[model samples]
Target: MERGNRIIYNQDGKIILQTGETTGDVSGHDTITELHYLDVEYGSIDYNKQHIESINPITKELVLKDIPVILTDEQKRLKALEEELSMLKEENKNRDSEIVNTAFEVVNMKLNNNI
Candidate 1:
């Protein structure tokens, strides 16, 4: 989907047409520098035929296709690592709290014994 400066090309890299917002006066208003869309502009794309595809890294282009989803190896590894790190952090916090409580209990026990 495209927005802002809505310009579509026909695979040949030629401008199909501009239709969203124009840089001109509208209803005797001031000249507009840009046109804003309330939501994503599909332009000439067929929503039914095409589905959301992975965006291109180099061109930042949104590709669409009606296909199944597959997670890459790197993506899976990253997810596993994130889960492991979260668990480790929770364990560390629990251990630290335990250590602090033990120290306090030892001090209280010694004072009570002397009395």
Candidate 2:
């Protein structure tokens, strides 16, 4: 009869498989004996808005404490360019609306004068 391997906990609460040394079934084991799975969902982090402040070893939870976003010079310049582009696009839209309104007013005036 073959004796199946049994799991045993060491004094440090580490799991050890009792496999005969002759069978060569024993391998290295992890020190973490108990790991509770968390059902929490983690969202994609925006480095500009959030930063990892610390991590809990036992729970393996990431602590995201809000702090001032650190950006490189190039990143700062790029952000400024994006803001400027948005403002310019808004101004262009307003100008186009104004031009359309002026054209309509001119057409109405011409119609009134002709009548």
- Top lDDT hit: 2
Kindly state the number of residue pairs that clash in model 1: 0
**TM-score of the candidate numbered 1?**
0.29
TM match of model 2 to true structure: 0.37
Worst 10 residues of 1 by lDDT: 21-30
Encode model 1's per-residue lDDT on 1-115: one tens digit a residue.
Answer: 2234556566689986665754544332345574432334757566656775666656657677864556699999999999999999998998989999999899999999984
**Cα-based RMSD of candidate 2:** 11.0
lDDT of 2 by residue, 1-115 (tens): 3344556766798976565433344454446666444344556777668787767877789788776768999999999999999999998998999999999999999999994
RMSD for each of the candidates: 16.0, 11.0
lDDT of each: 0.69, 0.73
Candidate 2 local Cα displacement, residue 60, angstroms: 8.4
